[model samples]
Target: MNAEHGTPASAEPGTLRPGGRTARVRAAVLDAAGDALAEQGFAHLDLADVARRAEVGRTTVYRRWGTVTGLVADLLTDMAESSLPRSETGSLLGDLTANARLVQRTLADPRQGALFRAVIAAATCEPRTAEALHRFYDVRVREWAPCVRQAVDRGEAPAGTDAHEVIRAVSAPLYYRLLTTAEPLDPAAADRAAAATAAATRAGAYVRPSPAP
Candidate 1:
């Protein structure tokens, strides 16, 4: 997948999100794929198994996805498309707090947390999955970046602040905790992440450095 455009090099009909009947098939297959990944991890994710779980024809799965990685890539794309939109709470802290809480809730969910772990593990060796993961986060970052721009406009964040970086900072700690420790992803942790990011953003920590003349 192209990082900038989040599209495959070949824009085939199979790659595109379909409408009507095919949309139902796509949703089923992706849900099955996610369940398999969460339960069995990437190494055991079989297309035939996913087809059976989805109650679809094996040939349909093969013809549409071709391989497990292809199916996984599409799953990540669908996840990004289905994620909740960023909150607009006027204050930068409020907006970032909303973002953090969303991340916390997602990581705290058993199925979603397991699915993310499976995908992150797969991305370690699979170049295609890695690219898909990059595109997934890229889409998310872009979605919330406008809040930082709004902060700058409102004089809450410094001028020349890197909006994308600020958005990333808000979620980075939550993800790290999810991956590293066994601590519960509580609301307090989310609030801490939001506060830290908002403070750093206002202090110009994320300001883009000017090029040396």
Candidate 2:
């Protein structure tokens, strides 16, 4: 279920650019899809059910998305496009903390948290969903990776720091906390996560390894 992929393939149908009726239909469908995923999880996410909630025809939904996997993949794409842009605070710690707080807030939201958990649970069983999940993270990681580069340019981090790894580190603990324990996600936890990762990066712990001999 850990299948990997890049951008979703061009083979998917029902994809639409922004604006017009097509865009509106896509938006409505995805919103309903998210609602179903949050309420009943992936296993229960039927395309027909989604169409009914979206007030779209079953044939339209089927023709556009083709399958549940295709619909989910498009949903991930929409999510990436709609997500907030990365913060630029002119400091590594500040940027990292901002990213951490964003992640914490997302996990703390009831509907959003349930949607993510449902996707993750489904990804474990569906290879296509797993690939889509990986792509979603890739988009998110790329979105925030520049902060580490800016830190390197500003001499705030080591020259060879792995920017993506640093960013992931800042969020990993928060996600772990969310998934493992029943603890409430608070601002303090986000700050601690950012501080710990920033300290590690400063110490060269996240430097990319040299290629093996």
Among these predictions, the greatest TM-score belongs to 1
Q: How high is the CA lDDT of each candidate model? A: 0.91, 0.87
Model 2 Cα lDDT, one tens digit per residue, 82-173:
99999999999999999999999988999888898898888999998898888888989999999999999998899889988998899999
Error of 2 at 68 (Å): 1.2
Give TM-scores for every candidate, taking all chains together and pairing residue i with residue i.
Answer: 0.94, 0.92
Any idea what lDDT model 2 has? 0.87
What residue runs in model 1 are displaced by over 4 Å at the alpha carbon?
Answer: 1-14
Candidate 1 lDDT, 29-115, residue by residue in tens: 999999999999999999999999999999878877888989999999999989999999999999999999999999899999999
Error of 1 at 178 (Å): 0.9
Clash counts for the predictions, in order: 0, 0
In candidate 1 the C-alpha lDDT for residue 89 amounts to: 99
Q: Each candidate: RMSD to true structure?
A: 4.6, 5.5
